[model samples]
Target: MSGAARQSVSSALPRSVDVAKVAGVSQKTVSRVLNDEPYVSDEVRRRVLEAAEQLGYRLNSAARALASGRTRSIGVVTLGTALFGPASLLMGVERAVRDTGYALRVVNTMEGDTAGIAGAVESLLEQGVDGIVISEPIDEGEVPVRVDVPVLVIGAPAPFAAPHVVTAGVGAGVLASAATDHLLDLGHHTVHHLAGPQRWYAARDRLAGWRTALAARGRPQPPVVEGDWSAASGYSAGRDLAANPALTAVFAANDDMAIGLIRALTEAGRRVPDEVSVVGFDDVPVAAYITPPLTTVRQPFDAVAREGLEMLVHAIEHPLAQPSPAIDPPVELIVRASTSPPPGKPREPSGSTTSYQA
Candidate 1:
């Protein structure tokens, strides 16, 4: 308990310094206890709570803004769709911001709105936010965003550049390479790809990763089957792929598409992991329960959020400090029944493929 490390580090509200003094703890400790962040012991938490209550140290975003040049609130511009990747990344941001004692202001952008992100940023600036998070942005050629505040662009390329703009990635290409290599290591001749739409940076990264893995192994690359990140599109792609007698493995962009592909393959008389092996990205909750549980790459949503926010808040607080070098989020590929060696070939536990090329 006491040995546990603080998962997130954030600045303390100015008024919180008094509570820290009264509780005989550092400002960071006070912030942790107040924000319900983990790692503090029960005794320290109780003491901090008691001191805060006695001093009436309530959180006031406006007061914090006046005192620290920060609203203590963050604005996020994200896609409004209920798709798994965007929704999950948004949820991770919500948790990370709250852990840092920061209030959240959100602006949802429709999928095809030309001015969505630019307009959303303007709206958030009208209110007031210390920093901004641009999550899962699609490739819109050129974006007209020129904000002065520190910006954290996650899982996508930065739309605009500025001294304070910080870009962090989800390592989607690396994760996709892992999924593709899993199939290649399973003794498949060549792994086929079920790609997401090219407009999305995430999908493009995954597609690039798949290509990298194939190239690394000197394997023949098949034409990609593009999906709209939906089950229907995957089903259609699956029907197309099932027609090829040499198809033995498929790497899907996400779990939804993977599931639909499985259905199509099943109906087409090709059994999963027997006639054809499948690997997916995003490792959704139901992936394990599905028939022939899916083998997939699990994205580190929480890790990426926490790491990106940490750098952003640092940039916001110390405008003159050198930007911290970003470390890639940890990537993990969950192995399951859907992937195995080619039919009549023995399975090997060692996926001793060389490191990811991209």
Candidate 2:
């Protein structure tokens, strides 16, 4: 048969036997290359890999798992919302998992109680996930869960004994403090906060940060406007904030709320950064293009995911003591048009022409 005919006639579902034949090596050698076992000579390893690639061979995950007693799959648990923070964090995590050569499985749960979270974990475990990552952990308001497999909890600390990886970049406390301090530094006498749900660790930490900033500077605390991390809730909170003439600065837990708050403030005839300065968190992509580009705190979701996945893999492999990994990524502040000194204070540049008031 012609070489082309031979290639075409080859089994589409290529196996280690086919790779061995093509590479002039034993099936054992091909298995070693697939498993990345040491002591395989470089030339032989290269030949085996080339043959595998040429034949479109894929290692059977189930067979490999059976042999090694590990599924070679990573699982993730997250809220079912399309919220930018969780969504972005998940993207980063998936990338990291793919890079680490593991199949990714995900389970989404409703944000009601710890039972939902527990259920998701159980589902992943049943599927035989070698490791698991919880992207957004709530207080869950239940007893801690015990996970036998290596686990990593993002955003909030792990409820049970496992490695907790804080998304590097911005912490709730850090962002809230920075946002409040920025407004105060710009001459806003006091700052009001539109807080996210108290059940969320992010929300509680942000609220604490705002309170800390205010108390440290001896500024009186205004009644907080509660929000569900939604634009609608922020709008509702903003209306309340707008009615109070004493309020000149506001810190929102996230950009979505900030956008809604800005809309409400504008409708109420309160000029943002002129009559009121607003700062938000997450620095969502559209934040810079909003009516008045939002001055916000940025979270490095991609970096956090990469770092987190690394930590998880390390835990899975080592299962013992090793050098500690950095838990949080450095937070960043993006100065934009939405923030400035309150009206009549020394006019600080907002760096953008989009007027929050206009």
Candidate 3:
């Protein structure tokens, strides 16, 4: 056949019979190999897979589901917001799911969605999925869902009462505490918190971390300034905070707010690390490139997703197995030019701190 004719024939959907013809195997054997069923020798399996690849033989999901009673899919419940933290974690989950060779079904919900997480779970359950990941960081205030299958709740507490549900994404407390400690170690009296909206469990966790760190050092806790995780909100908070001479250090919940706080501080003639210092969470892509180079703690989004999804998949494959112990990802505090000893205090020796000073 001419190249055009060959391409035209290949363009049509190839069936299992085509794979069987190319593999020189019986259709039964082809089916077994494609489905990853046992009893197929390695050599035959390779041949069948190679032929399927060459023919672009895509398995029909509906047929596969009927045969195995499994959709081999995972549903993710996440907030509809495009905020950096949740969005980045969701992207990490997407990458991890693809690596697991499972189809992804994401259902986005708003904060006030009447149906809530239960509704999102129901929608995915109707379509049939082997697992589910609830990446919603916001606490929906007791919106319950009937979670029968394995569920992985990342970056938030598992809201489901299901026995198969597991949680991932360690609290931001450790990272937040490290951030506060960094500022205190720089000779700041106490660290102020520019908290994200308290409705988000992440924000609350970081807030608690800040308090924990300060309390451990016997430093007095400062009143917290709340922001909506937006630069504008941070700017507004900064403008008000700029009037306080005691505002020497701040740990903003995320990078965008930190950037805004820095801008407001600079405009008010408070030089970063000289008059005031700022630390942020999430270590956004532009954190280092910002005017003063934000000192922040990095959230291991990919690592969390990979570890969490691996645990979820394990539960899906072996429901009776003892669950893998939760592994807390290392907290990395990236010290930058935005932090230093207070103006009148002596700076630490060169290369003195053990933290990852980026």
What is candidate 2's lDDT per residue for 1-358, written digit by digit as tens? 0000000011135568999999999999999999899989999999999998887565644445656678789899988878888888888889999999889999998877678787787677667777788766467764344455667767675554433232232356766787788788888889999999998878888899999999999999988888999999999998888999888889999999999999999999999878888999988889989988999987667866787777777766665545244655555778898888877768866663221100
Provide the lowest-lDDT 10-residue window in model 1.
1-10
Name the lDDT of candidate 3.
0.81
Model 1: per-residue Cα lDDT at residue 275: 90
User: How accurate locally, in lDDT, is each candidate?
Assistant: 0.81, 0.77, 0.81
lDDT string for model 3 (299-332, tens) is: 8788788888888888888877856776666678
Return the TM-score for each candidate structure: 0.78, 0.75, 0.78
Candidate 3 local Cα displacement, residue 93, angstroms: 0.6
State the lDDT of candidate 1 residue by residue for 1-358, as single tens digits.
0111111222433378899999999999998987789999999999999998787565434334555566778999998988889898899999999888889999999877858778898777666677889884588756665565678888766676544767677788889988888888778999999999989988998999999999999999999989998889989999999999999999999999999999999999999988999998888999898988888888878878887888888887887776676656456888888888888899755332233322
Task: Superpose all Cα atoms of candidate 2 onto the true structure and report the RMSD in Å to 1 decimal.
Answer: 15.1
Count steric clashes of candidate 1.
Answer: 0
